[model samples]
Target: MRHIDCQKRISLLVDGSLDGPAVREALDHLTECPDCARAYEKMVSLNNALTNVKPSLADSSLASKVKVRISGESNSAGYAWNFSLLKQVPIWALIAILAVGVGDMAGKTLTETLNMHDTSHNLENLIQDNGESLTDVLIDFGQSENGR
Candidate 1:
């Protein structure tokens, strides 16, 4: 038998459920295969430990109750299924959101800067001109009231 076949039958061997021929074959394989020997020893220890455990409760077999409890636990609580896809959300989505927010903030900052620049230019021109041409005023005012 293959290692896998021997492995599958190992549970039966550990539980003492195997027939005489199977027992002989398993022992023969154990003599040759160190990996199977280790596995067999582990299973033997687990079985011994399980056999030694005592039940505190009255009127119930410990092994059967433990089996039922394990079966229920496996059936009811194991293998949680989720359709929410929460784990599927990409880091790129967060990065894109961050990029869009930063771009919007940058655009606002640039627009405000441009508006300030335009306002500053207009104010400087107003200050320099003083609202009237100096030469026109000078020519008119320089002429005397007697039309000189």
Candidate 2:
């Protein structure tokens, strides 16, 4: 099976939703493939984490008090209708971002123009394709001297 489909099966197995045959097959694959085994282990850990999680009581009262306080403190600032300070923000930020972008582009262009050259690091590939020895290539390079 494709790795993606197998991963889906792994999730189902962890959720205890896989059929008998599918569970068996998933387990079998897990046993043979280390990647699948690691994935299954992760699923088990995730399942344990989810099942053991409980809603906290500590924040219940805090949330209610916070909402009341926030409501008292709130104004048009929290709504889309208030655009006093936010209106200039987009224009200023856009201009600043564009300036920085232009500077970066100019620097990169200058550097590229200064270092305009192509270099080939294909010694291994050349040797493999031509079935030539490295020592022979080096000797030829040394003798030729002109980099032919």
Q: List the residue pairs that clash in candidate 1.
A: none
Q: After superposition, how far is residue 128 of candidate 2 from its true place, in Å?
A: 99
Model 1 weakest 10-residue run by lDDT: 78-87
- Cα deviation of 125, candidate 1, in Å: 99
TM-score list, all predictions: 0.37, 0.38
**What is the Cα-based lDDT of residue 108 in candidate 2?**
71
Tens digit of lDDT per residue, candidate 1, span 39-96?
9999899888978996667755888989999998876654433323544668899789
Instruction: Quantify how close model 1 is to the true structure by its C-alpha RMSD in Å.
Output: 21.6
Pairs in clash, predicted candidate 2: none
Clash number for candidate 2: 0
Candidate whose TM-score is highest: 2
Off by over 4 Å in 1: 58-148
Residue-level lDDT tens digits of model 2 in 51-107: 899777775888899988888668544664466556757887979988987886674
